[model samples]
Target chain A: MTPSALLCQFRLIGLCRKWCSSRAFTCQAAVNQLRREQGATALAGRVDRFGGITVDLADVGLPKDISETAFADLLTDSLGRWKSEGKVAVWLRVPIAMSRCAGAAAARGFTFHHAQERHAVLSLWMGAGESKLPGFATHQIGVAGAVVDESNGKVLVVQDKNKTKNAWKFPGGLSDPGENIVTAVREVLEETGIRSEFRSLLSIRQQHNHPGAFGMSDIYVICRLRPLSYDIHFCTRECERCEWLSLAELARTADTTPITSRVARLLLHGLERGFESIDLAMEELPAVYSGMFYQLYHRQIPSS
Target chain B: MTPSALLCQFRLIGLCRKWCSSRAFTCQAAVNQLRREQGATALAGRVDRFGGITVDLADVGLPKDISETAFADLLTDSLGRWKSEGKVAVWLRVPIAMSRCAGAAAARGFTFHHAQERHAVLSLWMGAGESKLPGFATHQIGVAGAVVDESNGKVLVVQDKNKTKNAWKFPGGLSDPGENIVTAVREVLEETGIRSEFRSLLSIRQQHNHPGAFGMSDIYVICRLRPLSYDIHFCTRECERCEWLSLAELARTADTTPITSRVARLLLHGLERGFESIDLAMEELPAVYSGMFYQLYHRQIPSS
Candidate 1:
């Protein structure tokens, strides 16, 4: 029979089984009590796939003062059976409060895999071909700008050395440590020699597969900038060319990327209906936004 | 048998049944041909105790140009039997991309409830209680400060009028519209008359069951501040009293509430080791934090 017909038949049978099994389960409770007189093997603590068992120790806070011998004995007794049964892997997650047990974990061949504020994950492989992975994921935080000179009908644009010929957009670069309010301003100055005032934060963008930055999640913040000087002193190393382009020229240019074009359009729309800029370095969000953007789009602000 | 023992027995039975059903499902694929000869009724879909049938229409993007007669006929055919069957509630989630067919939804007696950026939720009720609810869930975003006088080994604090007799911790209040960087600064000034400089964000706390804020999730961003001046201008309307207390005093005070005490401790800890502050308004998170946090605590941050 066809897959669709088979699926329908399976659904019908499954529905019947669902009700019948639930009833049967309730009725056979007494029968189960009798069956329990004969020894039955107990099931493992978790779901398994590809010959791996997951044991959650999140709630089971092992006694802090337990001896290393006691802990090692417990691990061997619990997991040795599974290993002998040919289980290839085991996964354990421990809460951050119990981080003191890392020494105990290391004794059992378990190694730290990754961590967050509240918890840490560790993995053990019984049948491994030499595990050689980093203990933690790497990440990079960055800031970019969409410097706008709406009054002069111009916007700061840059052509990356690596991008297509004559492709120009906003000037921004990676944020350095302690570069709070001046990150975007500094980038704009370095890229196009324009001493710009960081007007408002436009959006934040994430690139998980950033080519050059492997094993790193690249975070980019796009900001709205107000330019103070128009003198062009472009960086030769990073950009092939940089200039201020009018909205008309930007819309008409074939070299402008879609992202830049869209940003321009959004800025044009925002300027028509002014902008209520969020002060990134200073402003705290109000207690009650009776009717505002936060609720409308969830708290995730738009970004690059 | 005892509850614990009974539970263990059930687990064994469940494991055996899992293998049996999976094997049975595969074997039955070959034997269900005879059942096809018998006429089968189509499945309406899920049944619930509350007499509600949830039919997700997110994938079924109705044509924008579909006629009113056609649209009404379609909805009637789909939901009329459900109504006659006495189903009292229906939920429909329409994605933002498919919002053009809102007219048809409204025509069919659907009302908007809550919304996120990607989608909007709407529900229809034929039950006893009159449904006077917004089509989307409402949320509030707030900012607070954990202002520190690190050099002096003290922190700004206040005793809220609603809290216990002498509970004093950090001075902060609900954020207001356009009250960005100056939120904590403004709050500190208003609460303790300390013109503080906003430094870094310590953490974001969420309270789903905030008193008086019914059906609202209160999101508060706790910030770190550098106090420039120390004067006490307590807001008598909101705060009973305000003061600057040493870290030792804060740690010693038993009257301080758990949240305030925790915040104080965290701020104290952060002083020894500075916080890695992310400016949410100007930062984009990488997409790769998946599986790092959600499963670690089943998706909710640890909050008191």
Candidate 2:
């Protein structure tokens, strides 16, 4: 595929001398350069493109009353017009969901190629050369806190026991069965004895089937929090130590994980912007508990 | 770094001889096996962790009456307590905005290590051993369309002219400054002549300082559209040819780009979900234009 473009062009141009003699016109940029230099030659000749007209029959709604015979007949009628238009190859892709379309295609000359779990690939070659079909390689809300000592410019992380990879991360885990605010407060409290007030929603990270998440898609929402207490008691189940790290100290050895480090960088940016806050106020709980999160935490906001 | 954990653990247990001689404990699971076998040996050693604290002073509201000397004194006092607690390192990360804090840190023994555009790293080592601080490696939105011939399970892409790589992509460029609806329609019109109606938002892609984007942060908002006409006359400035490809055809050869294929897969998933639509009539737009966008470029609908 890398050489397909220039090779296809060179075969049309009939100037594959450099290509055949030295096998040196390998680089794509160089091939494009040669194509540019020989623009006149390219203009003089018609492109010998891999000739094909693929009829994709997946998800398309066919006439509800059209018989399979009529579908085959319609395709047969189109083949003549396609040949008139100088298309020498025909590729018909039949989606797994469209068994009727696959039947109609099989009634014509199209043959089976390969398939993914989602869709099946089929092809009908009207030309003499080979056509390579595309290969199919297919491969939660997570919330964490950027619990900063806004008074002292320190971020809190717990020393993790999970094989000492970076050994530390922002202590909060995925949101439990509660609102983001409640989860933030509960996680921060559970992991570190420090009490924190949620300030605003900070950042959202999306991962699609990431291995770190056991091949699950998850969204991680990082919230900004203001610390209220000083003493920290580490969660014995998850971490070995609890640390209050400076933004600079975290940046120096911030290899605990990429997402955490990314969150740290953003936290610094927020400090630079003077920490503009997002408000969350309404909650059904008592003021002592509900007052902890940002003003917008308890209510849903409209999408922009 | 992958094997460093097990190697470091082995060093603590005086099992370096067996590890180095055998060279068999290579996989992570194997190392975990060794750890399980020598669980008691692991328990016998006291864990040694590099200890440090960083003071971030950027956005934190320092008392208006306190002088830099008092802040320095506070940090110095913490140093003695940290040392008494067996902490061997002290780190102070000063944000670029916190110049005054950097001055106070300089008054102490904190030396500059490295810096990112947003923050500076500085550290003080009180330990008996070497302290290696972590350096900073710092590293946008884009919108693209997954134009599907829903009846035929085909996707539409244009052969790009810029390079040989991923020559095909859904006919799209960056959106202009107007509403995403306007940008979607306009960019689509400019690239391909097929008139389409904006259905709803498909995906939001954020490209931050990407090389293709001239190192600017941008958000790419993709919108799904229903094609009204079939003929496509490609824009000469950007692409060479316009094509309608089936999912199987794309799967067989859809190497236009990773993101494009990802969108295609998502589009297939969307089709499986019967292509659920997102509403947008409530946007702050004149009823005439927004109405036209949704209603075949000619009509209006009563909003629910």
Candidate 3:
């Protein structure tokens, strides 16, 4: 890293330390509260974020305690927070022993975030010791989409071509070679010409349900954007149609699929709040653009 | 990149293609706009981002426009955009004819981002009447801090070690070799035992204004984080006493630095946003981590 970038990072760390130092006392207070009620399992998962669901690796059940209901609440809360303050995704691994209970989650139709490779090894290491754990590698990637036009209570939607005709979707794609999710969103826009802005992170839709898709799709912090201009373009003939449609119109669209429900809800709710554009620092343009470039020119440009 | 990772990426590519097909029409709209805008040079001088700033062969200034307002705007925008984008520096060339104009930027109090490297290079072409543009490399970096408490509002703060213990600062040190801004942040946190969440990316402070310290300082993305837990881990004592301070109480302690202005504003806004955490795919982690580790520890650690 360049000296300037290094220095910038150092500054953030310092703040984290300082923040932790002050919160140390509070953590101590909560430690006791957590220890009393949740036992070791509850205590382990005590880092409760309001409107944010915390997966308790200890329980590992389908339709886990944090279900669609909890997810919706958390998502709403998160979207509000993300509007002004951008959102971030943090991926961490729980030790196999700590995460073993999560394995049972599959029976309830719950899937571990990185179940195939990372979680697989973790489960084996914890349940069957080192000998039984299959050796493989895994990585978690987060991709986000920015809703550029949510004017007239209608969200801008892109109809993908590779899939069924008339199906509505978001104007975003997958991560690129050597790029991250934020970049992926930017790339999709630059290619698709849907001037978008990030709104709130939608959901981390893993590949379990869509075995056809494979692995996991870490949908990033979604956002609502105001397209400066409506003229759409395709760097390549990737998508069939990009349009601005009202939430009700989208619902009534004959081609709307069940998959679009989440996006529909997000857009409808965002429209009600009257989304605002977030200030983007010029310096940040490079990363955003480059990230998009990586996604477009070099990334696994997403399909229908 | 490993073979498995490559395969996984291919799968993702297929998914992207399908997504693109579904949204082809929307993409065409954006494509038209892009075609119209292509003739305009407003997008000129813009760098190509390939994980870092890349000065496209076409955009790097030719001699005539070097000292023009457009030139300055391009440079300023580039600097501002890249800096905010979290890039350490930008690489470009000053056409040999524009060598005379180099002083123009310097005269305007604009300094090269990096002082250690040769500022410019002269190149000779093999063809007749053909001359190569001279080259220059400059770099910049920023540092950020997040102050948080367990209650999600407290963080440890300190007086600058270099300063006379009057200017309150985060307990972070300069970045080391082979590290990104995030790496720098991690290093500082490891040394300080402070856990931080990335918040709003702050300004990329000018390095010329290094204060009493040896190196320059820029305002990075500073944030407010909730401390999770703390341990007395040390990477050698690098600070004076560290204290947890509430955001409300920071100003009461010492006059906050101009660098901290954004942080203070963010705190006052009562915005709760999480900082960005990098997402690397699970199947690709070993190789990615290994690449970094190899550079730093190849000689130290024996390959299995």
**TM agreement with the true structure for every prediction:** 0.31, 0.28, 0.31
Candidate 2 chain B, run of 10 with poorest lDDT: B292-301
lDDT of 2 by residue, A45-125 (tens): 122345656555542333322333444555665666666667776655443333234345555656544332233344556
lDDT of 3 by residue, B1-304 (tens): 5565555445544444444332333433443343345432222433332233434323432333222233444445445554565554344433322322223333333322211111221111222243222211111223345555536465566554434536655555433222233443464476567665543223222222232222222223232334455553444435555566676666345555644433444453442442221111111112221232111000011112
What DockQ results for candidate 2?
A: 0.01
lDDT of 1 by residue, A142-253 (tens): 5577777777778888889865467767787654422342378888888878888866555444344443342234445566778788788999978998877886678667
Q: Which structure is stronger by lDDT: 1 or 2? A: 1
RMSD of 3: 30.8
Tens digits of per-residue lDDT for model 3, A1-304 = 5565445445544544444333333443444444345442321212212222233333332122222222233323333433334222211222222222222222222222222111211111112223321111111233445454544666666776666466776666544323434454475576567655443333333221111112211222233344655666755456677776777677566676443544465455545553221222222222211232111111111121
CAPRI tier of model 2: incorrect
Fnat, model by model in order, equals: 0.00, 0.00, 0.00
Model 1, span B174-260: residue lDDT tens: 643223423677877877777877665544443444433333445455667777777677789778877778776786679785556
The ten-residue window of minimal lDDT in model 1 chain A covers A292-301
Output the number of the DockQ-best candidate.
1
Error of 3 at A108 (Å): 55
